[model samples]
Target: MYQYSEFDRQFVRLRAEQFRDQLERWQAGQLSEEQFLPLRLQNGWYVQRYAPMLRIAVPYGEISSAQLRVLAHIAREYDHPDAALLAHAQATQDELQASQPGLTLAAPPLRYGYGHFTTRTNVQYNWIALTKAADVMDLLASVGMHGIQTSGNAIRNITCEALAGIAPDEIVDTRPFAEITRQWSTLHPEFAFLPRKFKIAFNGAAEDRAATGWYDVGLQARRNSAGEVGFTVKVGGGMGRTPIVGSVVREFLPAAELLNYLEAVVRVYNRYGRRDNKWKARIKILVKAEGQKYIDAVEAEYAAIVAQDGAPHTITAAELARVQAGFVVPALSPAGIPSEVSITAKPYQRWLKQNVRPHRLPGLSVVTLSFKRPGFAPGDADAATLDALAELADTFSAGEARLTHEQNLALPWVHASDLPALYEHAQALGLVQPNIGLLTDMIACPGGDFCSLANARAIPIAAALTEMYQDIDEVTDLGPIDLHISGCINSCGHHHSGHIGILGVDKDGKEWYQVTLGGADGSALSGPAMPGKVVGPSFSAAEVPDVVEAILDTYRAQRSSAAEHFIDTLRRVGHEPFKQAANGARHAATERRSHARQAEAATA
Candidate 1:
């Protein structure tokens, strides 16, 4: 975890105060909504379907118990149904409706007191109130957390592999670079307003846990023959309306010149990237349009910047050392060694196998607390759950916990000997689902339920599927299946990278889901980096489960053995078999319902 310096603390406090002042002016009608929109967005506030959503950056998803406690306090104080914040939200909604009589307000859902974890490793409060927005910002600032640059057409939160430092195969502890990037990109004057929102990811490990290939700009830490650390920079990769894996703009960027190289890339995009249409504004579209010419231009821009700056913005050993010092590796105790405490529960054993991984330290283990419990929306945790996690972090993980891109929480330094006790405690908190990469372990975005941009409700589908796949043995049997759903084509759920991807679409004002097959993350062993291909025509939300079941069934039938993964089976067998099965299952389900209705009529 990065500790805030006096300067950092003051900077955030001042920024919060600035937002507070801006809020007062906007509310007083001193500034038009148009004038206030960018300001609010820059602070990570967005007006969604029912209420405002504030996305707080977790800075590579590393959070201490103290910070988590602050979030818990915020949720308990502001997000509860009986909280004054809800009243404020209702008043705001009422005011909007009063001004525009034709507006139909969506009914609010029951209070769950939980903030959601996004695929970007950030936490979002989807039901924040306009009145309490500033207060919430101030509270987050108290814990050195903020939502700044989390939204709008600016550089978003810098993310890295959640297990960066702990991963055994890591070439570099990416926390230093990730923190450095956060510092540089935060409130940057030059790239503040790009053509579109830019996402950057750093992967310091042997495997691409950070999904570097899917981000706007990807930097993979590497070493030269001389054992010098550097980065392999890739550019222009993104998902959404157009999904393209990034191209290697610079094969090996010297670690010292990282910031300069980044500046050059941003400068090039700012200069030539599309601005006329929001749909075509992403750098991927620009890169696609210009092809090799764009890469050449970026290289040329890099040269010019280097020449003009006299030397690139080189990082010194002292600066790197200072940043590295912020990350704390807890001292190991001999008590952390694994114990031979006899037999355990079967589910606990499964959880240990699936959710626990070997940490870089011999006696310590990294434990993933599953958030994909059945009947709950994936990546969601109530305030109470968060508080429990905060306490658990203090007790087990050295008071620090990391959030994964998969929307789960990770205790990166759990003593292996304490696994049984931790498992019992986690089970009590409804956090021990024992499903990490199984079929039930889903990644979904808030669709029509919260986000105004959604075409359908993604949470419902995720919940329904999770419940449907309640047989953990069956789910595990399916083997390492990545099921992802998004309310729309924004790819916020990273649907394009799931083994079974579901994208919600609007047809005749009704929700329809498009299914994609063979989508896998860059760390996938089965194939190359690419978006999942749509299997066939879209299906209704009701038909989604059947379709998903059919796909799994097909995979099971085609797999050579239990050892073969779902993705490998899909790639080997292709989509035709799965397509046929999906259609057949849907038709059968429809027919069965119709026959039951007919039988009831006959009885009557």
Candidate 2:
């Protein structure tokens, strides 16, 4: 974890105070809503469906136990909505549900007092009041956390692989570079307001755990033939209304010139990127529309920035060393390691195989605590859970934890010898599901329940699927699968990269789900990065569970052997069979609903 310097601490506190001033002026009628919109957005406050949402940045996914405690404090003290506001919101939701007679409208009751872990490794509060936004910002600053550039059309929070420093197959540790990039991009006047929101990700490992191909800019840390550190820069990859894998712009960019090179790339995009239309504003669209011409433009821009500006942003060796020093491995206390355990126990063995991963350091392991459980929305941690996690991190991971892009928590510095005790503690907290990378370990957004942009609710669908797949044996037998759900096309849930993607769509004022098959996130198991193909027409919320099961059943029947994964089988065979099976399930579900309706009418 990168420790915050005194300057960093002071900067965040001053920013928070500035935001408080802006907020007070807005409340005092000294500023118009138009005047205050950008101010609030730049500070990461958004007015969603029912309430104000705050996105707090967790840079490169690294966070301390103290920060977690502050987040828990925010959830407990500030996440609550006013009683009258909650009642009014509930009434509005009920009316919306009643308006659709035949639809199931699987919207759960509005929830608050919890923080949602986003795919980008940011923490979000859905029900926080706008009045308390400044207070919350002040609290976050106390612990070296803030919402700066988290919501606006600025270079959002920089992300890296959760296993950056510890991955066994890592070519270079990306955290230092990622941190350097973050500092440079933060509050940079030239690129503060791009044509659209931009995202950047870094992956240093052999595997693409960070979904680099699905970001506006993806940097793969690597070494040249001469063993010098550099990056394989990929630009224009994104998912939303348009899904495209990034194209490699520079095969190898020297590590020292990272900031200078990125400046050129963004400068080119800022010059030529579309600004007239929000739908086509992302750099991906510009890159897709222009192709080689775009790459050439970037090259030309790079030349100008280097030749004319003298590469002012080039990272020096001393600066890189300073950033790297902050990420030093924690000294492990020998007493913290548990000595004895029943290694052969089935539950313990299953947890070890599923949740625990190999670390670059011997006698240490990286453990993932599953957030995909029944009842709770995926990635949600209430006040108590957040506090407990802080304690867990202090005990098992030297007071450090990494928030994963998959919306789970990772203890990156756990000793292998402490597995049993850690397992027991995690199991007690309801975090040991042994379902990492399985069907039940799904990624889902807060959907229509909180997001006004969503056409349907995602939590109910995730919950339904989670409940149906409670049997771990069945899930393990089915093999590794990426089940992703999003309420809309925003791709907040990264549905475009899932092996089986479910997208909520609006059809005739009713909530319907569109299913896609054969999506990959550029992992070794998932093959090349690509969007999933839609099966058929959208299915009602009621039919989503059956439709998903039908797709899996088709895979089971078509698979050559038990060892074959779901994604492998889907590729070996085309999407037609699976599509047919999905539609068949939809039709069957429709007939059943019709029969039940008929039965009720006859009794009346």
Q: Rate the local accuracy (lDDT) of all candidates.
A: 0.84, 0.91
For every model in order, what is the number of clashing pairs? Answer: 1, 0
lDDT of 2 by residue, 1-604 (tens): 8988999999999999999999999999999999999999999999998898999999999999999999999999999999998999889878766765455635667778999999999999998888999999999999999999997778999999899999999999999999999999999999988999989999998788788999999999888889999988999999899999999999999999999889988989998888899999999998899999999988888888899999898899999999999999997656455635578989889989999999998989999999986768999999999999999899999899999988999999888888888888888889999999899999999998889999988887898889888999999999999999999999888899999999999988888889998899988889889999999988888888899999999999999999999999999899999989998998898898899999999999
Lowest summed lDDT window (length 10), candidate 1:
100-109
Error of 1 at 154 (Å): 0.9
Task: Summarize candidate 1's per-residue lDDT along 401-496 as a digit string, tens digits.
Answer: 999999999998888888887887888898988888787878999877778898877876787687678888898888888888999999889899
- Per-candidate TM vs. native? 0.93, 0.98
The alpha-carbon deviation from the true structure for residue 186 of candidate 2, after best TM-score superposition, in angstroms, is 0.3
Assess candidate 1 and give its lDDT. 0.84
